[model samples]
Target: MKGVVIIPTYNERENIIPRSGGRRNASQYGIIDAVHKNLPQADVLIVDDASPDGTADVVKQKMKRDPKLHLIEREGKLGLGTAYIRGFGWALEHGYDYAFEMDADFSHDPADLPRFIAEIQKGADLVIGSRYMPGGGVVDWPAKRMILSHYANIYARFGTAAPIKDMTAGFKCYRTEVFKHIRMQEIETDGYGFQIEIDYRVWRAGFRVREIPIIFRDRRMGVSKLNKRIVWQALFLVPRLGLWNLWR
Candidate 1:
């Protein structure tokens, strides 16, 4: 089945390009290269939000060389949720059978991509790269951050009652058909909440959901996009969605 990997980026030029001798040095092969190495048949789509660091320029350069590389440059910094929303629409218009959500940085390992495709081929509609599952964990995070992340997932799980371990995970794949069933226009939250809402809707819609083990690493380069606003949105939105689901 044909698939597209959608990466939403803001100020991720360093991670998209190969650089020398720095803590922020991207992967030796760069994210696009690593993805191509793992899934040569899959196409890569970059949904850049007009980063000041010339991130889109690097993508354009790569696009010139590789026809499989595609880009959607937003006028400004739109939220990650909208970027993926736009990407999902584009994938549907272009006739891709499956779509993937991945980070621009190396936080989500490209090597695990094959496993996701494997699960999808086996008839799973949504495959999550879970960090809370057995054999899956985080690397290079502070104790406080890790604790918060862990409990946040628990809280989200309790709130949404999704049958998966990692509700806030950004690393996942979806059958393009799932989006056709979900009410795309009604999704309001962005950031972490976006992941939860989509997963909850997919499960509620009776799609088969599966989780695979993945060791998530913090970004090796560029600034983190996470903020207090995004976290707070998730905190409040989960219970609301859960309560709303009870009536349905």
Candidate 2:
């Protein structure tokens, strides 16, 4: 099946550079190489938010050498949800069968790309790489931060009543058909809440959702983009969406 991996980036030049050692980092070059290694049939789309560090330049350089690589450079640091939404639209316009959401930070392993494809082949509409599932976990995260994430997923799941184990999972694969059922224009939540919102929408649409175990590694090169506003948005949006779903 034809598939595309959508990686969102912002000021990730340090992470996208080519390193000497054979490390599975989150750089643009490393990620493209890994995706090709595991799923050569799939294409990659880098949605860069006009990274001042010249991250888009690095992707453009690679595009010269690889025809399968695609890019969309936005004006500024638009929200993460908007980046993926734009990527999904591009994938549909280009006639892709499946669209995958991934991070450029290497936090979501590119090696797992095939696993998502395998699930897609099994009639799954949405396949989530879940850290909360059995045999799934995180690496090198602080206790306080981990607790926050763990409870956040729990809270979101409870509020939304979604069957997904990882309601806030960003690493996911969605069949193009699922997108046809979802209102992409209505997805306004950004950051972690964006993940939850999509998951809930998929379930509400009656799409088959599946979660596979994956080890989520922390970013090695650049700083995290998480902020207080993102956190607060998630905290309030979950219950609001839950109530909205109920009323509808």
Lowest summed lDDT window (length 10), candidate 1: 18-27
Q: List the residue pairs that clash in candidate 1.
A: none
- Judged by lDDT, which candidate is best? 1
TM-score, predicted candidate 1 vs. hidden true structure: 0.96
- The true-versus-predicted C-alpha distance at residue 56 of model 2, in Å, is 0.1
lDDT of 1 by residue, 19-89 (tens): 86667422577899889999999999999999999999999999999999999999998799999999999
How close to the true structure is residue 202 of candidate 2, measured as C-alpha lDDT? 90
* TM-score versus the correct structure, for each prediction: 0.96, 0.95
Candidate 1 Cα errors over 4 Å, as ranges: 21-26
Off by over 4 Å in 2: 20-29
RMSD of each: 2.0, 2.1
